[model samples]
Target: MDNEFYNAFASPISVTQNALLKNETGTTQKPPKLMDIDDYNGWSERFGNWVEAYHLDAWDHTEVQYFRPLGSDRKPIPIRELSDEEKKKYKNEKLMVSLLQ
Candidate 1:
């Protein structure tokens, strides 16, 4: 993905830390944990814009099945009610991981 696009999805702080980690360890780590849904929505919006602007092909990778986030009571959060903060955090994390590779 493009740098500008990645930047839009990630927090400035995370980006800086990612650069530092790259310089120090010669390897990067997982993305910081996200806290809410706004983050995820922002990332998805940026990603959508990138795909539209660049006319990129759709992802064709295998889909991994995972459990939905559950609270301490083990009740899954409703999909429509999920938050975006964690998603943004994860997107940054994925970017950091890509930098390492």
Candidate 2:
């Protein structure tokens, strides 16, 4: 994957955290499950730390960026006319969402 292409659409922390992940163990802790309101405080803190470790917290500060292919002229290509490669790129965004969820 092109880090430049990926970072172009990502939050600022995405670049730094991703760089760190690449350099480090590249493993993240799973978030603690929330069973009920009673567990909210502890679960929230642990989950927040887990997401932050993986830079998934970027999603909380940024709106979802839908993939938009660029044409040769450098303008965005219509979503309806995506090539197979573009479709694959679009799926990358979905993968990020799945990670956060």
**Whole-structure CA lDDT of model 1:** 0.46
C-alpha lDDT score of every prediction, in listed order = 0.46, 0.61
- In candidate 1, what residue range of length 10 has the lowest lDDT sum? 56-65
Write model 1 residue lDDT over 1-101, tens digit each, in one string.
Answer: 69888877697888887776554333222222323456666544544444334332221111222335787788977655567854543444454334323
Off by over 4 Å in 2: 1-29, 56-100
Question: Number of the top candidate by lDDT?
Answer: 2
**For candidate 2, what's the RMSD?**
17.3
In model 2, the worst 10-residue window by lDDT is 22-31
What's the alpha carbon RMSD for model 1? 16.6
